[model samples]
Target: MLAKRALSIVGGLAVIGWPFAVWLVISYAELHILLPILALCFVLRLCTLRGKTGALSRAFKGLAIAGAVLSVASIWMREAQLLLWYPVVVNGVMLALFGSSLFSSMSIVERLARLHEGNLPPAGVRYTRRVTQVWCVFFIINGSVSLFTCLAGNVHWWTLWNGMISYLLMGLLFACEWLIRIRVKRRYE
Candidate 1:
């Protein structure tokens, strides 16, 4: 269990740091060379997952499989450009996942919030739904930008946007949402 958690943390950091790693250190397009290795790691990680199969869990599995397949294809074809498409595919998948949650029985944010807060007040439910919608829109826009950067064929631009700018924007959103959530909780209380 500890090893699995450690691996999960490392994988998350690697994904987060990939753009920076590619841009600054591995600027020679050697990043794509690691795809196959990463795919194997992903396979190992997926095999370790143990839980009830829910929609969210299934979606995560789908993403893991997709990443593994993309990595394998990049290796087989020896095309570095395919690596550029990774963020686009990821963002698109996220857009779909968050968008679908809006109309489902529980919004993704609500589901997460419930884990801490128990059954939400009516206002809390409404707030989570709106927050989920905001996330869906953010994903759509972020994915579009990712697609544009991939097609633009500029490594520097892709690195800057996907690596730095996107993360900054996401952090800003998270901060703003957290501030708002405090207010929301106070109002409900």
Candidate 2:
């Protein structure tokens, strides 16, 4: 579990950092070589099949990995801009996952909360669903922004938004949600 988490962290940083690094000192060719390997190495988990994850989820992951590989192969100096869509693809997949969960018995956030609390209260269930909805909307907006930046044809904006600003906004969202969760828990308790 630790190894998988570590691999994911490293791979995520590499993907998000690649654009900035490319604009700075890293060669685009070097990034192309590293990106696909990182995708397969850290993105594809052999253990994912063992989990209760849906086949559709697994298929989505496979598609992302394949897309990453194809992007690497097709990438050239002029076409390097195509790499900007990587985040959009990622967020789109996440949006699907979260959005689908909303229709299920329990939202994904509720499942994660249950892992810690074991049994969620009525209020908790409602809160989790709201949180899950928030995440779905966030992914949609984030993906849209990613697509817009790419289409705008500015590498600096693409690199800055995808590499730095997006992460910051995500962190802020997570922190704000966590704080809200605490307040909700207190009210329920």
Highest-lDDT candidate? 1
Cα lDDT, model 2, residue 163: 84
True lDDT of residue 66, candidate 1 = 68
Residues 73-166, candidate 2: write the lDDT tens digits.
4443435555666777778888888899899998988888897999998989999999999999999999999999878877788778888888
Q: What is the C-alpha lDDT of each candidate?
A: 0.77, 0.70
Point out where model 1 deviates above 4 Å: 21-32, 50-52
Q: Work out candidate 1's RMSD over C-alphas.
A: 2.2
In model 2, which regions exceed 4 Å deviation? 1-9, 21-60, 63-67, 75-78
Predicted candidate 1 versus true structure: per-residue lDDT over 27-90, tens digit per residue: 5665555666667755754654556386667766666676667667767887656667778877
For each of the candidates, give the backbone clash count.
0, 0
